[model samples]
Target: MIRAYRNHPYHGRSPLPQTVVAGWLGITQAQLSRVENGPPLVHLDRLTHWATLLKIPESQLWFSLPSRTPTNRTQQIAVDLLAGAPQGIGLSGGSPTTLKATAHEGGGTTDRRQFTALAALAGFGGNSLFDALMLADRKAEVVGMEHVRLASSLVERFRQADAALGADELCDVAMGVHTRLSTWAARSQYSPGLGEALQSALADLANQVAWLAIDGERRQQARPYLNDAITRARIADDPREEVRALACLSLLVREDHPSESLHCAEAALRASRGWATARLRTLLRLRTAHAYAQLNDVGGFDREMTKARHEFDHGPHEDDLPFLQFVTAQELTGIQGLSYLALGRPARAAESFRAISSGPRAGHRRNQVYYTVRLAEAEYRCGDIHSAAQTGLRALPEVRAISSGRTMRHFAQVKSRLDRERSASAREFVDAHGRAFQR
Candidate 1:
């Protein structure tokens, strides 16, 4: 239980202290500490209040308990409700039983009460979804979404949170929602709003997928999803959405059509201006700089890269977007490093890449692979074949796990370059993992 409490780390980072938390619950700090250190003996009411105030999910809090013991009938009912439908069910499934129990307890089984219970379940589901995503355990993520759908009201809340949290944050909630809704939509024969919602979710998923693809050097497969994301964004009737799609597309296509990439990215920036949040605008500009580098427009790349760095440095806290709250400053620095590499500035690229390479491993695995690949390429360009080979070797495991053609292509490109030098280790790594490069 102490391990669980300490592992979250978010609690320590929260502005509230143990005393504040205890005071809020009308308990002494020592009691709270004991609760934190020992088995979860805190009342469900107290736990729920603590979770809400701490911005942690109650499900996670419950799950963190040393033993899966339920304190009361209500807690047991909640556990059954959570376990019976690992994926959520409609108001009918076990909801009435729970509601009746609540009413009997003098809690008045109103629709509002039911809705609140559902929301809490969904919030728990969201936390589970986030955990699965962080681990890159796609199978677990899929299961988590089933629960998210039970808390259907969260979908709208996620959407509303998007504006405040930015695209990255939106992508977090959107991922599980997208997967769930897509399955639901297919099963329900494409219901109204479902298609639009799925499209919105897919657009976000595609961006992450595309990022993964690019990281794994599977550019070809990445392109289709990027294009699909754009189409979905257009259908969703949000210019800001379209801008994000186009910006990502620009990154995938930049090498093929640098001028067109720049044009598209510029257009996205223009469209997003004054319409999207500052983070969105900054992301668009970063995409433009990448395109500029591909076009060998050094001046343009430098200016835009500088702008991206400045904006990123002055950016809002990650907590502003609950979904993307995990994204750190180092990730943005990696982007700038890639921009430098694209502009043919090997030294500057190396500096940026080193920063990313040395940073903590907390973000997405795909992101780690992406920056590491860029660093390897930069090392190769700077005539450090040994470093490049080493980096390539390190990145191979992550690359193999990804299912993107673009990422494979990037790997192939790097491998091909290194293969010419007959580096035995590099060749061995390639021979072992080359199967993943296939389209």
Candidate 2:
């Protein structure tokens, strides 16, 4: 660990003596010697104090500790966490040399102890770090848009940890930071990279919050965030991100505002042409189909679905962005199925749904719930009352857990259709799940 510290650029240029550091920290020379040479417990306060005096971020101090050998269990755990970080969450593990350089660039004195702690926790497979960062960000002392942005990104990583994980707090923190950053960015002079960073952060936060609101049965609440995301994406001048935001808005508007949904989706496709990767193009196409189906445009939906299918059939390479890489054929099939159902093509919808439901990729519970519900709706439309009821039953737990208003609206639509036929099972399912829509 000592060698690692020495090699760090922050430490390499004009290394501070132990005695000098100890004096600055107001600690005795002998005590500083113990801290440097033995199994000494570095108090958090003292660590932060020394970091300030050394003009290095506290994160650098923690990450650059001489005792952080690969053999050290804690340090090894930290390294492992950095190794497997998800995309959009920022850098995880890199070469030690690279980390040292980055720390130097970010101004060694910024105290990101909480980020280090959260990263370490994520590496160790603990979710509590997610909560910790959210809590810390709420405190008054934790200002600085960059720090808040980092915390928000960490929360998003935690959300993507698993489908079942609740990201309410994460979303809330992200929204708060997004609001604050937008205000600051509006007033600040133009900085080369600053505007882009602020725009990206705001867009990401809006997306996260919109997702959470959608999950929590708050479609009305979700709409503004989705719109805000679109604004930020446009400011960033990244058509792919802009289209992604529009896609989200399309989903929100599909039921009641089909024409608007179609407009957003088509605009997304047009804006994203050539600028986006294949995966993004696939998503845009899928969304366009959904919008067309909502407008009862079967021909348009079919054309878009065909294009989307072709794109998904060609799997993304490993080098693709991690976020986009997860958009698989199975997922595309599910979306295609929903589009068919919306277009009143029960047979085609069932075929698409069956293809997805029969796959081994059903491990994704969130997708399973979404697809199952769509299948149930399609079965009802096809007059397969028994199958529809059974599928709805299987999807009930997920629906209740997720409690999305849009999902409940879909459920209600299916239930109303089934009710006309006096299907007892459908009635029961509605009785149990319909209350979510009231909120």
Candidate 3:
């Protein structure tokens, strides 16, 4: 057991690098390696910190207890609950290390499965990336008015991809478009309309890149791109892009800075009040609802969600921004369900999840896994342990295929709940899923 921790496969998948994890543990990386590599003389306090950082189960850790514990397990529950686990940001993992357009030949290509996944994602993404890359390689004469159409199409495609794929699969491709747009803007001397159009394209792509960063679970790292998006949005004076940038900032800060989240949501609403299209307004209301949920303001959450649903159902989306078209009544339902989770209304949350999908679409694999695990959480919260575990177990195969910090967090949360459960079936379910996640 002591030897197992040295080369634990768990650290390989962790978004936090060893240096960052060691910092959180208040030790040097070399010290951490030494402590983790050698005998089981690491202190109880350090073990507690590791459990909290990695979200390990107390029961599982105690089964191979180190000999260094002083006495009784008085601190056992403290280690188990970890009610206030530190929310350290993960370094962006699985993304291209830089914004450079990666060459497909030589050693740049990833695994076959990753290529397949990227292909599937790009299919739903309308091959805009492929088209953009092709145009990017040609002279400026080859990039005419159609580049604008392709840029707009890219936004819509990414909106679909956002709902379907996990963020890791989305990040690098988004950055590629972002870089292309930047290069064109810097070198080409276009007319006023063309330049504004180019800036709009750049802003939207930057927003997508930043939003994907948030979705990929690297919110802190998203700040630079997000700021660039906001600035370009103001330059282009595009309300839709501004709304997205605001909502993303709101989403990013809702956990750590709820007040700021509310402010950002309000800023989104204010920016879009008269100039924005109806679908854009609905998106803003949803952002506001999300912030309200984070603050536990039930009335505010319900009100904004109701408005979001009503506006989405009745409003004309024909004139909406292409990317804004993704905000459907069905997607809003999922947001409402998530708000219920924040409000501690598991029954309502489960009901909402049930409405999002009666059946899964073939290409929307990641969405299926995410919603299934969410439903499992609601079931567990309502004390239906058997159904909860069974439902979650069904998604393990899909979950294994993708990597998302948000998805991993949900798994960790469910694991914590199952660990505290007294039911033998629940424990068994935890064990099965536990090994699956370790892979």
Tens-digit lDDT string for candidate 1 (134-216): 22212221222222232232344443333222222223223333344344334544434334444555555555545444543
* Alpha-carbon runs more than 4 Å astray in model 2: 1-128, 131-152, 158-162, 165-177, 180-192, 317-326, 401-403, 412-439
- Decreasing TM-score order of the candidates: 3, 2, 1
Cα-based lDDT for every prediction:
0.53, 0.57, 0.64
lDDT assessment of candidate 3: 0.64
**Poorest lDDT segment (10 consecutive residues) of candidate 2:** 95-104
Candidate 3 C-alpha lDDT tens digits along 102-146: 443434244333534665655832432332222223345333334
TM-score each candidate. 0.52, 0.61, 0.67
Model 2: lDDT of residue 93: 44
Q: Tell how far residue 161 is off in model 1, in angstroms.
A: 21
Candidate 3, superposed: residue stretches over 4 Å from native:
1-107, 111-117, 124-150, 357-365, 420-422
Candidate 3, pairs of clashing residues: none
Q: Is candidate 1 or candidate 2 better by lDDT?
A: 2
Model 2 steric clash total: 9
Error of 3 at 425 (Å): 2.9
- The 10 consecutive residues of candidate 3 with the worst lDDT sum are 77-86
